[model samples]
Target: MRTIAVTRYVTPLREGGSLPAIAEGDDGFLYVLKFRGAGQGTKALIAELIGGMIAKLLGLKVPELVYATIDEAFGRTEPDEEIQDLLKASVGLNIGVHYLSGSITYDPNVIQPDPQTASRIVWMDAFLTNVDRTCRNTNMLMWYKELWVIDHGACLYFHHSWDDWEAQSLKPFAAIKDHVLLPFAKELNAADQWAREKIDKSVLDAIVELIPDDWLSAESKLSFDEQRTVYKTFLWNRFTHSSIFLNQAIDARKALI
Candidate 1:
């Protein structure tokens, strides 16, 4: 385990409804330090680190992330002191999320990716355990003419446990429903097929093993491992028995991108 000490706590820049950004690490890295806020919790922090890391491993574009522990002293106020005290009182916060530079924000409708491209992102999200992309918010970034997804701190299908399965709610996340209807479905299917064949039990296990233990402490790490197991199991099941959706996503991605 590599332990990087906290060097300095920088002022936070608010983005959307997400956590505040704090500190520029000695290593020239920027991190969003999750303070004890109105709604922040351990689950969100864990999900962000684990989900982002998993997406990177799945060969998708994601921001670099590192876990950090902030102490009370680092949470003191600045000269401006306009910021809320609790917002700065995070010790042992998630730090070192790469602050993207020269990135432009665009509404989901503005970037208008083709159906194929959109399908690929959907497939990627489904396979990598992302559960945050929804109708109201498709959090993404456009830089250098490329669309990059962010704020996956709500992934891992934690809500799947709820059995409500309302029609409207299901429609949004049913990767099956969205991707299969895409015109680019066929191509996305082919790509997913190829990737699926390459993925085996050992490979999945190896990927899970690479997760940093520091990010999830001993007890929490165990729970995190269980989540990975469920993720892999669901992935295999979907690829084997429900491949139609996967195919559609692949084709859709090709058309959009």
Candidate 2:
């Protein structure tokens, strides 16, 4: 991932709990930055990094993700104490998604993606065990007449508590039925086949490796390498047993249709 120095504190995007912000990067681009110092801390950033990468790897449309550097001087002028503390605590590496200028939230009633696209999104969410992306909060955007996914901090939930991660990997995501795109996801089988072909041990390695050590240290008591292993193992297990979730999605879609 490319690292950019955050030069300006544009504004705080207080939509969600993490308190993401619109910041200007040294590259002359505006980015929606996910701070590492927020309540969820670096774990959320890890999920955002891995989830966004996997989506891009699956040929999904996602804004460019970068490692945003929060230098000591940044955010010093923010008048809000909460925002200032968040900036002070996050004076290091954070995650940023290139802001899609003029992008609007996706409205299911206004437009529905094709079956194949919908099915792929459903399958990907199931694979990640993402619990966000619902009617109330679609977490999707329409930019330049194309669909773009964002805010994946809710994915990889198993990492938050690994006590049953092994078993958790095999369980189909029950929440998938509530997915915003499930109604049009008629191509689950096709998505299953595609994912099985695209994601492998190497692909998982690449994505997991992108996670900075700072993010891994806060998780559990395990060493960074150990945590990475657990993550890779869990993801591989889920990928191999994806049928469990694919079937769950198909059943849910069946009920919906």
Candidate 3:
């Protein structure tokens, strides 16, 4: 439960576009952190922490994460800095998906993700409400010839507030009809089994246990735990009931074959 302190706020990196960025520290690590949007709410904050952890648990090579606290002295002084310093005290973490190296942005065509690989990301996003990707620009990370997706602070269905998330609402994502879908629809369709296998109760319990008490109010902790229990149950018992989801994943991979 060691909350990383904001050592020195460095210049913002612009590649993240809408997301805020800066340098920060923990007991012994230096990271370029990404903050959730201003007044966004705890759901998004927890998503970055919990979602990153879950992705790691699922054996995805997501970036390392440690909960961070932002203080007033490090607050922003300009429009560009506003998002980074949104809360007088806020939580954030660094993403290892990409860096501010001399070169940025890669051609998706050159580093094509197979339907299975692409579907896995889409499946992760659907469960998380990570709307950063779409038909137009995937905006995923490409480093050392690998695809790494970052910037999930806006996930976990933040748009739904703290209410119990509906899985059917997540079904639309299973359909195949567009540029992004065309590439990975079958794989997305076939992912119901994977989702069922991956989103297990034991894993969900581990995630809740990892949340530091300081990051949550007593009431919030109660609600979050309740909701997580519900979510885990639904994913395990009912997620694969949708034929479209399983079919989209099948179609996604079929395109590649």
Candidate 4:
């Protein structure tokens, strides 16, 4: 992930509970900044990092992620108390997704992706246990006539309760029925095979390494190595048990059909 200094807080993107903001980086690029101090906290950022990297590896379109440095003083000029408070709390490192200019939110009713792409997305959500990509809020964008994924902060939900991560990781993702693309995903089996081949141990390692140490420390009491190991174990277990999710997805697709 690239690191950039947030030069300006442009505006608040009030779509979800976290209240991510659009900011201008020192590099003159716009980024949708996910604050470290949001209600969901650092774990949300961790999910975003891992999920976004995996999506990229699967040949899905996702915005570039950056380490956005926020100074406490950046919010001094902002008149809104909520924005001011958010910036003050997020004084250090935060996650930023490169903003897509002139892009429109994906509307399934108007635009439909090919079965191959749709299957890939469905398989990805099932694999990651992402519960956010529903019909009401697809978390997808239409840019340059292509589908791009965004806002993966809600994935890898097993991490939210570390008490039984191993067991939780093995559970089937039945929520896939609500996935916006389920109706169009006719090639899930093929997508499953392709994803399994790409997301090996090395790929998981690379993605985990992208997570900043501060974020990990802020969220868990575990040591850095311990946290990394936990994440690796959870992902490996989920990948090994992917059949549970795939079967659920197949069933969901049939219901939609």
Best by lDDT: 2
Q: List the lowest-lDDT window of 10 residues for candidate 2.
A: 214-223
Clashing pairs in 4: none
Q: Please, what are the lDDT tens digits per residue for candidate 2 over residues 107-136?
A: 999999988888888999999999999999
User: Which is the better candidate, 1 or 2, if ranked by lDDT?
Assistant: 2
Which candidate number maximizes TM-score? Answer: 2
Q: In terms of lDDT, which candidate is stronger, 2 or 4?
A: 2
Q: Write the per-residue lDDT of candidate 3 for residues 36-60, one digit (tens) a residue.
A: 4334445455556666766665555
**Candidate 1 regions with alpha-carbon error over 4 angstroms:** 1-18, 33-40, 78-89, 93-95, 114-117, 159-186, 210-257
Model 2 global lDDT (CA atoms, 0 to 1)? 0.92
Global lDDT scores for all candidate models: 0.53, 0.92, 0.53, 0.90
**What is the Cα-based lDDT of residue 217 in candidate 2?**
68
For candidate 1, lDDT tens digit of each residue in 1-257? 13344566676666544456666665666655544332444445555655566556545566677656655566465454535454354455454566678877535545566544554566666554454565555656677877666676656454334243222222323453333224333445544555565556676556556444444444543376665565455545544543545544444445555
Total clashes, candidate 4? 0
Q: What 10-residue stretch in candidate 3 is worst by lDDT?
A: 94-103
TM-score for each prediction?
Answer: 0.66, 0.98, 0.69, 0.97
